[model samples]
Target: MTRRIPIIPTAIVLIAAAIMVRLGFWQLDRLAQKQDMLARFTAAEADRTVHPWPRGGIAPLGYTRLQLECRSAGPAQPEAGRSASGQSGWAQVVQCATPEGAKARIVLGWSSQPAPATWQGGAVTGTFVPKGEDVLVYADPPLAGLQPNARPDPRDIPNNHLAYAVQWFLFAAIAVIIYALALRKRLRG
Candidate 1:
């Protein structure tokens, strides 16, 4: 006697497996895109040459060194920041009036304690970093009492797409194996 595979269940399993595999490939594609973005960031950071801050409307400043002499427009605004050594702490961000009369914010430095007295602003040299809709300067050789926090890395961005892809592929294999085992058991009985 010949045994026939259950058409409905078998079709469902194949469709599910195909979808899982497709999801895995999609994740892999995301991984490649992430890697390319990181590479671009690195390339931008390599050149030490500093450029003047843009006088016109805002621009994309993901990874570039720049020079600016901004005076403190207000007291320091505290925000989260990471140290060069990867320590998490509070960073002082001060509002400043640019030479062209544009309002801008600059991340002064990272510290374990709350921000010190009202920050005394000066001619600052640092890297321009994109933060949400605003761009802030991450001071290099950080201001006198503060530690250096410059050249924020793109590698810091999480790139777990490959691992997620592996998980999807594994899920597809597990589904196939379980279905095969169930089919064999049904055939035996």
Candidate 2:
């Protein structure tokens, strides 16, 4: 059927289509970044052992790789972030066991979202950062919520941006298509 299309609608649709395409690309970029980051972390941990934080005299200013046993389970707590609103994070922990089965415990900060847990005879290679220096003795507790042991697997985190990007791009495309139809109708009219 012949119908009149308006220029405004046509223009809006085209603009929307362009935006959607841009969003889709953004998601792809995010996915790439995440994969790269995962690869880097994996490489760093491979063939490496987790170590205790250096005691004093200038912290390594970096992380130390250490392998913790699975039996070292600890309750995780939220280590507040600088952001005004942030999730109570997992206060990751490590437990060192003596041959006799006795144990020493330490609360480690979140090592990203747990990835596919690497285990060779119940051990995990993780980077150890020194307990952040606390100027106020009581201001922020250095450690909290310790458990026996655990080896959380690395998760293949979803990149929703890709989906969102797709959505935006789809919207943009639809917008453009609508605009084109509108323009066509208006021209005919």
Candidate 3:
């Protein structure tokens, strides 16, 4: 007669399978959310054209109720850096104006890290993006005028969840295959 296998090991396998499947589903859910956000942003951009003023500034970023356009684009602060490719780099978001102008705003989000600040009266050209909950505009970036508090740092770290989800699913598939072969051998006799 063949010795019996312990139940504890079987239990462990079942638990692992459950955990991996759950993780895969979680990643999928996050993916859906990201897609939805992308859709909304696209629609907003399409619905309206960036309206810039020849000699005017836009309403504060938080005040998305207003839409502004760019008459003259400021010096292209070429964003340079490497974080996650496709979305990486940092540059100033300057809206041409003097020190007393209320429209020297920017369309850049926020960053835990700070970038260089240069407030030299230059030029600005970009569309108006309604600030979202995740968007954070720096109110003060060392420079007062000629430089926007928002710096363009395109190196937005991408989500690694999809990779993680794939790994988890692969683990689960392997577990199923190994356990099935073992169980088949045991029962065949």
Residue-wise C-alpha lDDT for candidate 3, range 69-150, written one tens digit per residue: 3234354343443222233445344454434443444433222244544444433334434344232223222232323334
| Residue 121, candidate 2: alpha-carbon lDDT | 24
**In TM-score terms, which candidate is top?**
1
lDDT of 2: 0.44
Residue 19 CA displacement from its true place in model 3, Å:
0.8
lDDT of 1 by residue, 1-189 (tens): 878899999999989999999999999999999889778777778878887776466574567788777855578776777777778876777888876776667777777767552667777777776677776788776764776543477667789999999999999999999999999998988
Q: Work out the TM-score per prediction.
A: 0.73, 0.45, 0.47
Q: In model 1, which range of ten residues has the least summed lDDT?
A: 142-151
Better of 1 and 2 by TM-score: 1
Q: Which stretches in model 3 have alpha-carbon errors above 4 Å?
A: 49-90, 93-117, 120-164, 179-189
Please give the distance, in angstroms, between residue 119's alpha carbon in candidate 1 and its true position after superposition.
Answer: 3.8
Residues 62-135, candidate 2, lDDT per residue (tens digit)?
A: 23354334354444333422211233334443344423353433444333344222211234344433234521
Provide C-alpha RMSD values for all models, in order. Answer: 3.6, 12.8, 9.6
Name the top lDDT candidate: 1
Greater-lDDT candidate between 1 and 2: 1
